[model samples]
Target: MRQPDIEIYLKDGDQQAVTDWLNATIGPCTPWRRQGQTFKCQAANGAPVTWLPNAVGKWHSLFIESERTPWEDDPAFARAAFAALGVEIRCAPGGWQEEDGIDAADRWIKINGEGEQEFIWRTQ
Candidate 1:
């Protein structure tokens, strides 16, 4: 079975900064090629990744499309990103499930000020 894609959202940081951080953390990626509003590149592990800067409000969305990515899941990526970029990052708690539906519960895992992951349930 295909592994679930890893998704994460950044609270802040420009495109260049995010690309740089990804290179350093997940190993160097190929030069970013823009495709409309999103930028795509291949991670060191050969996973296809895309970065959509400011895709959601002020948060930048990133998607790891393949299981080849070095990290195992969203929280793993968020932890590494928070450490490297020192920025708040958000991701679905325990990854996303279609059965839950897009508006189902709307819980998230966000990095706190003390660099800890916190689970938050959005009322909306």
Candidate 2:
């Protein structure tokens, strides 16, 4: 049960706390899309980033947790924010393996405790 690297794309004018950023206080899927299978995104001041495909399942909900103290942490805000964004979070387990659709269809996101795992958020 290993977690993937979680890269975050913050906004230029975003001066919020780290937890706020993870909570999606500014927005959900900063530079999100619903048409194409793959797309690129850029932060307010950073360079461009890309999202191939994180997972499949009509994109119900999304959440993040720490592998060390996952159970001890509270993801209420994240869950609510995701719901507002149109997703339905069902479960969240850290230190797991996942292969998001970036390489394949939404059928990826396999939690195998391996390589580069990140969230690569967009704000532009």
Top candidate when judged by lDDT against the true structure: 1
| Best TM-score among the predictions, by candidate number | 1
Q: Estimate each model's TM-score.
A: 0.82, 0.29
Clashing pairs in 1: none
Worst 10-residue lDDT window for candidate 2 reads 6-15
> What ranges in model 1 sit over 4 Å off?
1-3, 102-105, 115-124
Ten contiguous residues with the weakest lDDT in model 1: 115-124
**Please, what's the RMSD in Å of model 1?**
2.8
> Model 1 — TM-score against the truth?
0.82
User: Scored by Cα lDDT, where does model 2 land?
Assistant: 0.31
State in Å the error of residue 36, model 1: 1.1
lDDT of 1 by residue, 4-93 (tens): 688888887667787888787779999889999999999898888899888777889988898676568888877877877788888775
Clashes of each: 0, 24
